[model samples]
Target chain A: MGGKFSIERVNEYLWEIPAEGDMRVPARIYADRNSIDFLLEESRNKEWNALAQIRNVARLKGIQMAALAMADIHPGYGFPIGGVGAFDLEEGIVTLAGVGFDINCGVRSMVVSIPKGDIEKRKEELARELFESIPAGLGSTGSLRLNFDEIDRVLTEGALFSLKRGYGTAEDLEYIEEGGRIAGANPSNVSLHAKKRQLKQVGTLGSGNHYLEVQYVDEVFYEEAARVFGLSEGSVVISIHTGSRALGHQIGTDYQKVLRKASQRYDIPVYERELVGAPIKSQEGKDYISAVRAGINCGFANRQVIAGLVRKVFARVFSTGENDIRTVYEVGHNNLKVEKHTIDGVEKELLVHRKGATRAFGPGRREVPEKYRDVGHPVLVGGTMGTFSYILTGTAKGMKDTFGSAVHGAGRVKSRKQARKGLSGEKVIEELARKGITVMAHSNKGVSEEAPDAYKDVEQVVNIMEGAGINRRVVRLRPVICIKG
Target chain B: MNRNGHETLEHTADMGVRGWGENIETAFKEAALAMIGLMAELDRLRIKRRIKLECSEPELEDLLVEFLNRLLSQIDLEELVCVDINVITIERLGGNYCLKATAGCIKREEVKERLLVEVKAATYYGARVVLLESGIWEAVCVVDI
Candidate 1:
């Protein structure tokens, strides 16, 4: 019942949804006709109206240049999934919706020194052993039992705290964004309820889309970059995708109420109430930011514990130390950062919010770790259980055009209900088993919803990023053992 | 007890009401019934308290999510159980839409067993209301324990 959206081909791979009515900045989408067609189909069904939400986000206070949507954009709370937007630090607003409910929900990829043959030799044992050792399912608690004091340390230190606890190595911090910790985290700002939830679930894999997969380097696209990331063809790897579970959800709910009143106080006329936000400098905004940063640390710490479990599983199965499966890179896709970027040819501090998108700083970006500053940030794009995942490098073009951000994964194409209607969870398990991929999940629905058929082709999504010069492909990974909750 | 029915629907089994009807309104009504099933007699309750609430979400499914979450919050703050779904609407506003819902609660003496957990709210997880060609509605919602 709305006006038809007109399309303008900016390039072979880019399309623009021009700013017309109340839109302060234009909405730019990076996708070909096939991608856009899939997007339109999702939008037409009113399932993923993220394209419209992207336009609404463009109208946020202090927004910079333009609001961008990745090829994998889907409907989310405030900003659409796979959406990217930045705001000027002095005049900008940090809305919790832009970063999403699951704060710091990102991907962590580990490079193993061993080969796939070694893993295949003990495949079934390794699968069962990993499933039993690692905790999964809803409200699952990890091995670590943190007291209040240690909880405070985790909230403040992020992965570093886990590292000190002997869960991860110092080198693991090298490839992590902000070294597995978002700075300026004040544990005091976190709510008591959030702290209580975080106490028991440090290393747990919470339900709904969270997973731990043992993969092999199936192929290499950029040999030099792959080698730099310690990747060799057929080498084993591990990937963990989750976030600050209940802690982040609690923080999002808490701030939503806080910002609801802050919006009226600050006179922020939001296009949508879900985009409830206040100036970054406001008392409410500052408090929420602190809590969100702590949530990011918890996520980093969560992944660290998962890594430790992986190490233990390997130790029991292969007798090799977990340190051998070194951390390749870790990044939080759903997060907001105060990064300095050149906007309109002037250096400006901007609050960059990436939802369902990864920060892909190209070569020479100061944020890139010292060792690989010469190459670029390792962008981990994970796919569904039965599909292929990729490791890509940030490009200079990505930094200049899209604030150094790239798509996170192959976005979901169907709803969980639709997936269930089309396929049975039991059948999906059998299919994976026949394919030689050992699948172990806490719940059948979890496995079915994350069926490889429910998502867009990761190869296609990665191709879009590479073709757009946003990221360069490094290595491709195929799942060997998958654990889901 | 083949609890496959609970898994078939998107919600957990803590609250009463095994399944919900299709469509947002029916699903919401069924959820209200589900919540009330945890408290006193639904049939004997009168439309005494008419509290209005609204929630917004980016997607229709998320709208169901916010709707349940807000309901849970109200139940916790007011200690009231919704007996009826008077005027429930899920319309798309600019980017997100509002779920304008009205409900009533019965006095304590009129009810049987009290609900176990103060259902803080229903979330987006496993929330579904799909309509079939035969006009049958199927709905599910995972309530917060």
Candidate 2:
């Protein structure tokens, strides 16, 4: 199978997989030489291969250009994690695999006025406060329990619903993607079972790689960009990484059945059963798009509520005004968005599906918030529990190349079980504490699974994006307090 | 190695459950139990309630996914963790494969503190249900977290 696929180096930072067999378009990968070598090595084995999954995406109907994979590309259920693709509105199809099961799973960063030195002194207390305030781990329930009507409003209104309920201020909405509300969300497209699952799960950080971290800007790469994005060396910030929870999961489960049937009815050939999709104009496709948008809203609202909770903790812990803590940006990695992009010298509407990838719209794009319109949207890239996360800005070159997208985080290098074998949660906690970082988790098993060595070097991942000119580095954030599920 | 049992398999980001038994029905039951164990400590959960599930699909693979997803839905709706599964019947009906099973669930409160990981949905990736030449039945699949 590896021999069947030939990859040609287009440049130092790009590789191309030419169209072959049933593939309608070629596939391009953005990675440095080392990352490409790692991928090639992985391709040698017959197990779930990322390159093959990328090609399978190319075979999907009405794929506008080529399938794209970021430097963090890894084998996922259907679409490779860190994969991106766009489909023609009139001819392309939508698949549940593209958006992923955890719909709109994303990262949001908030800047605080406190300095790094002050946070370092209170890291332990802050970690404890955040861990207790934020419900985490498997089946963790939050304070909010919505009924049928309230759930419908959450599906439709998104973060605005949370705002109306006094979770956060109106200003927070401006920094959120889609103003914290994805339009065309139809609660009717969501099932009652899905709603029931989300009734008590909102604002909770579900397990497995989801976390809340208190960090400080350790290094400023592009000083001007950092200034414009409200960052300074040694300033403290908080990052929340989570998604739509059970609601999004149920939506994916419900739609997989519909799209599988749609594939059969429309006579669409599925290379992998998980890659099944229906034509974008077909009834199944429309319904899925609506339901996914509703799921996206659920994510926005969840993060918004969590952000409010974080602010409350910060105010109590640091004795700072809540108004001083402000959101820098909120962006979803697993999602599908209908956007206008220039293709072949023509601007066309395409449904862009980014799985384990983040949207990095360049400056002047209307989608970017007005305050930072001249500096481009901030791309929040979260690292593993003990590693350094980065903030990068979208580039015009990225808009021209990979549909204004960048790698979401440091891709995993090992399986959780393998990570747990060599690492102990208590040992990891002690090591971080020795380095002046506070760590808290509900389960030692969760901590062992999220060991820092399990992930690739995030600095290297970000450097590739910068080298490729897809995204510009802003600042690097090192964790002071980390909380895991 | 056991005649009917399940084991947790390693996946890079998520997790996998692989089960084996003497027949397909038992293999499916083992897979369901594996999924339950991954979510929480199944030993601590008591069978407080029982729910019957019936599903039919044209493909055996789809039937397996449906079976697991139905169990997941029951967990979310009832706010409970499944502890046991009893396959009453599994047979080919016309062109479709049909399954009827009873799932016993315990209230979430009983095992909330013991929960380890939350599985969102069972995916079709690398899914397989096969009868080996050794006359043993096997089923394997990955679940999203």
Candidate 3:
């Protein structure tokens, strides 16, 4: 750990580090005075620096305008958590660093017909049932045992495969972005080892910050959007936040090795080796994009399975039927999607890489699901367990500003060591119970590491997104129960 | 100041040992001793079991993660408690790398407690090993518990 890297204010909400050394473009960050100051203080003299991460991102080959960091930014291996970068399809490079280890690590929120009061009555049983129904923790295996062929279909088809398997419905596919599958995934691009890892782990929630949360719509800020989402202020909801598990990790790892070698061979200079990459249309880049999309399919299918499990748990606890529970939307966070975004008044197909960030397309964007076209894409901002989570919708202003991306969660403010030092897993659990939030975990330390206090205020992060007009707060749901793995 | 921080132990000219946090270090050190104990006593030839440990992550988080995972797996396979460690190096180039260590093994007769499950590998998902401002070397490695 060293000292703080300073920032220069570019505008009211945008800060920057000038194009330096190998940086092809300036590094920009979206933060107010408060968050910016906090980041500057927290990153003082450590190997981790969002500034450095931003700079490295700006250096990615064929980046347009600037490399952007979202409000909830935090230092990560190559790109910061809430970092975003865009590269031209003709010449821009796609780096795995921008997508992260958990490919398609995303949020899937569903609305159920159950009343809030009734949910409160059965919350205790619901929490326990959910914890058991959903396999979690390290090396936890799901009930599904898939052969390579089945895994390939699941990877290629995403949620559609689950719908075909009778786990989900065709209607669910209509509600999902990209119909729950990203095109260009070649199962052959995925390694046998990766497939082996995915065999028994499809529906399992690998530990550390991954969770299945049950929430209720606390209030609605946008009535029409709420109506469109099939959610009412008091409607009970379920949110599953997870990713491609072992399969995605392997894809990212294998591609990173290839990218690192590719960068060297191409004579591309990066601030760090982890930031190595090549153009999205290049042979190397196309292979990774294909593999990553397949991984995205894995995640979508995984969430669908988990959603089925959620319905099962709810039915077992409340004695209800599957019709009572339904998925609202499944959104990807850590991914690179090639989309047309106007840069300098010209529309170009750019590889938009969002790491620890979520897509928040504004109203009228053809990419948004039909139900949400009038308002914008629904953005799910998860809070720490035992805190209030939020459902926000994208805004038109966001399209003009941040390429329609928003913060994923209250960014982690404390390191795991610092979190563990101040809080004990047992004590954190007791505190949550005292706050009327039921919690369950396979590991004690897991609970402590994810204590609400370990992160920045969710309200503040959401407020920033809302205030910036990138996303509008639709509803806030306080978690009455949470299950951690 | 405590075992939870970095505590160094002398082993031989080439290898030594170190404990990680207070709890894991105590466990890992015990694991180190167990490995050494196995090495010391295995010359007599009793039983043999081939053990495999696997942990995943990018290169940066590998050094501390793999080191801890290797020890944890040895503990499960050998059914012994390791109490000490003499660490040689925790370095990262393209990825993570570990050089040397020394440890002690718990005698079977002295075993009074066992862990929740076998630790197959330590992953890099949330692993962080660094020396802090307070002179504490902290790591947040996850084992395949």
> Tens digit of lDDT per residue, candidate 1, span B1-145?
3211222222111222334454556655665556544333356556557678887777665566566556544543343556776536877788986778877764332332322223323444335566656565545554432
Q: Could you estimate the TM-score for every candidate?
A: 0.81, 0.97, 0.82
Per-residue lDDT, model 3, residue A485, is 75
Model 1 misplacement above 4 A = A1-3, A41-48, B1-29, B32-145
Q: Candidate 2 on A65-162: residue-level lDDT in tens?
A: 89999988888878999999999999999988899899999998999998777787777788888999998887788889899899999998999998
Q: Is candidate 2 or candidate 3 better by DockQ?
A: 2
Evaluated at residue A248, the lDDT of candidate 3 is 82
Worst 10 residues of 3 chain A by lDDT: A1-10
Which structure is stronger by DockQ: 1 or 2?
A: 2
DockQ for candidate 3, please give it: 0.08
Question: Tens digits of per-residue lDDT for model 3 on A1-485?
Answer: 42334469976677888877767888888788898887676567555566667877887788888888888887776788898888888888888778866889888888888788988887888887898889876556789989999999998899988777767667777767788988888999988877877888888876678888878877788888888888887888888988888788767756766786688777777565467787676788889899999999999999888888888887777777877887788888898898888766887778899999998888899988887899887888888878888888877677766778888888887765466677798899999899887888876676776788988888888877776667888888877778887
Model 2 has an lDDT value of 0.89
DockQ metric for all predictions: 0.07, 0.70, 0.08
Off by over 4 Å in 3: A1-6, A10-12, B1-49, B52-145
* Reference-based lDDT, residue A402, model 1: 91
Worst 10 residues of 2 chain A by lDDT: A42-51
